[model samples]
Target: MTTLRIILGDQLSTTISSLHDIDKHNDLILMCEVNEEAQYVKHHKKKIAFIFSAMRHFAEGLKKKKYNLLYTKLTDKENTGSFKGEVKKTIRQHHINHIIITHPGEHRVLEDIQSWETDLNVSLEIREDNRFICSTDEFTKWVKNRKQPRMEHFYRHMRKQKTVLMDDDKPIGGKWNYDTDNRKPPKSNLTIPKPCSQKPDQITKEVISLVNEKFKDHLGELDGFDLAITRDQALKALENFLSKRMPSFGDYQDAMLEGEPWMYHSHISTYLNAGLLLPMECVKAAEDAYLNGSAPMNAAEGFIRQILGWREYIRGIYWLKMPGYADMNFFNATRPLPSFYWTAKTDMNCLKQSISETKKNAYAHHIQRLMILGNFALLTGIDPKQVSEWFLIVYTDAYEWVELPNVYGMALFADGGYLASKPYAAGGSYINKMSNYCKNCEYNVKKKTGADACPFNYLYWNFLAKNKKKLEKNHRLAMMYSTYERMDEKTKKQIKNDSLQFLENLT
Candidate 1:
């Protein structure tokens, strides 16, 4: 029987499970740059270019391995623009009798794959995606009978199971997390090492041209498009981070600096999410770094936790509660996202800095995403669906599985604290402490209520007050509510009025 193995854009790794049993000379390896995936949410132009270039490179690698491949470019006239349409076309052309596909990363895509057996009249084998440390079945089993699936507990389980950061059955240094040690504020004159970049190869240049012509009106410009497209380049990036950035990375992982977008960051999320870098590979390298004394324990452990712990847990929560999880809106926040999010025209300096960097580079570290842009969206009551799409559209590292839980649960608390224990709401004071954004702001960070006051200050309190009924019982938020309650009646009213005026004026 003729067999066709389909590889999705994110499944660019040769080690991907679907390719394991392939008959190199007979079975056709099919890869397509379909229109439907690219235009799903008007993804950033650079993201389109990045994925397309990487896909093309991966296809070339397959051909080099003597694998019979059917690669479909986007501009091909026979391209049908949808995965199903392309698959049907391929079946007709090749007269394939059977198909094999690794499970996709998104629910909608998975739902579409479910119909292939009935719709195409072919035997379909959907292989388990073994790239993830936690499979869907594994996560489902782990979540059983648990009221709240906490990431820390899950992290510890993964640590013990994988033997990562462990010393003879116990966690290394008697701790599974060094997150507390990783939160040092940005120190003055901190000279951060910049991340490594790769110049565009011919394949990438062609893809960039295609994205420029096809997705001109997309979120970001591809002017200086630079990212590792192949596995070797991705490994180089890992080495660069270990040697240059990893030492300071743990110290200021949470700290943000004005004009320094790549401060002590791995900048490897795009690579990791794309399958160019495997999770355990990155985790092991960091572990090796600490073992050899090239990097500190906190630095290595913090990096390992993000990939082995949080990244895996986020994927688990996504699969565990999806389809319905996307629709959840616990607070029923209905405010429209302001245009400034798109144009980065906001008067709030922190928002402007974060959004501007996002628009330029399709990136912002976790703090900027959580404490600044996301905090604003939550405080201003922007619709969760709208905010989620904005994040998906603007970030190169964002896939539905990873992005959804972060936005719905971690950022907006829209899933009723399913993924996070409490809402990640924060006022301007937090931003001022972590970043230099407040130094040049037009609005005073210290002011709580007025036109000249930082909007986050009043909006933070206003969010707590508005959601008092829903969040009052949350133990984590008790102190915030107590602080809000201690304010005099007049102060409360002024805060309400100021928040109303500020939100009303937002456009």
Candidate 2:
């Protein structure tokens, strides 16, 4: 039987499950750059270029292995602009009767593909994606009877199951997490190692031009596009991080500097999420560095926890609660996102730096994403859907399965503590302690409620007062609520008025 094997843009791995037991001589490989996926959320121009370039490179490698392949470029005049349209045309043209595909990263894409068997009147096989250490069915089993599926508990299960950083059965160094030791603030004279960069080759350059022409109005710039487009380059990037930056990655993982965007960061999420690098490979590289005395145990454990713990746990929660999870609005926030998020025209130095860096590199470290940009949206009551969509659009590594839970549950607390123990809301003091943006900010971080006061100070208090009914009983936020309650009535009124005025004039 003639079969058509389909590959999604993010499924660029050669070991992807859909390619298993393939009859390379008779089976046809199909890859397409369709407008429906690219423009689904007005994705960053660099994001589009990276996926297309990587897809082209992956297709070339398959062609060299003598596989019969059908590829569609975005610029083709006959492009149908949607996956269904392209697949229908291909099935009719090739006289194919069977189709096989790896599961997609996004839930919506998976739903569409599930409908294809009936819609096209062909047998379709959607193989399980084994790229992750924990499969969806496995995660569902893990969380089946638990009241709260905490990441820390799930992380320990993963470590034990994968045997990562384990000494026989117990965790190495007698601890499963090093997050506490990883929270040091940045030093004034901190010396950061430079991350590895790959210049665009002919294929990547062609893809860049294509993105610039077609997505001129997209969210990000295409210049300085230095991501790895293949597995070889991605492996090199992993090696560079291990040798040069892994020693101090734990210490400064949460620190943000004024002009430093990639400070001690791996910058490998784009490659990892794109399937150029496997999560276990990166984990083992860090573990090897620790075993050889090149990197500390804290650094290795910290990095591993992100992938083996948080990344896996979030994916599980996304699959478990999705289709209903997307509509969660715990605080009923309905405010529109301000124009400054796109333009980076805010007087708040923290927001300006984070957004500007995001536009330039299509990346921001975890701290910048959570404490700075995400914190502002949470404090200001911007719609969680708008915040989630913004994150999905602007980042090179963002997909709905990962980005939605982070934005809605962890960032916005829109899921009411499903994904996080508490809302990550903070005032300017937290930013002042961890980052240098406060030094140059026009709004004073010290002032609490006045014309020159930092917006976060009053907004933080205002958020607490506004949500007292829903959040007051939670033990994690009891201390914050007590402080709010102790403040004099007159002082509380001043803070509320000032926060209201600041939010009113935000646009």
lDDT of each: 0.91, 0.92
Which regions in candidate 2 have their CA more than 4 angstroms from the true location?
Answer: none
Residue 255 deviation, candidate 1, in Å?
0.7
Candidate 2 C-alpha lDDT tens digits along 1-507: 589999999999999999999897899999999999999889999899999999999999999999899999998888999998899999999998999999898999999998889998889999988798899999999998998889999999999998999999999999888889998999999988877989999999999999999999999888888999999999999999988998999999999998999998899898989899999888888888988899999899999999889888888899899989999999999999998889899899999999999999899999999999999999999999999999999999999989999999889999998888889999999999999999999999999989999999999999999999989989999999999989999989999999889888974
lDDT of 1 by residue, 1-507 (tens): 689999999999999999997788789989999999999999998889989999999999988888999999999998999999999998989999999999898999999998988999889999988899988898898889989999998888889999998888999899878888998889878878777999999999999989989988888899888899999999999999999999877889999988888899898999989899999999999999999999998899889989988999999998888899999999998999999999999788999999999999999999999989889999999999999999999999989999999999999999998888999999988898898889999999999998899989999999999999999999999999999899999999999999989888984
Kindly report which residue stretches of model 1 are placed more than 4 angstroms away from their true locations once superposed.
Answer: none
Decoy 1 TM-score against native: 0.99
Native-to-model Cα distance after best TM-score fit, residue 113 in candidate 1, in Å = 1.0
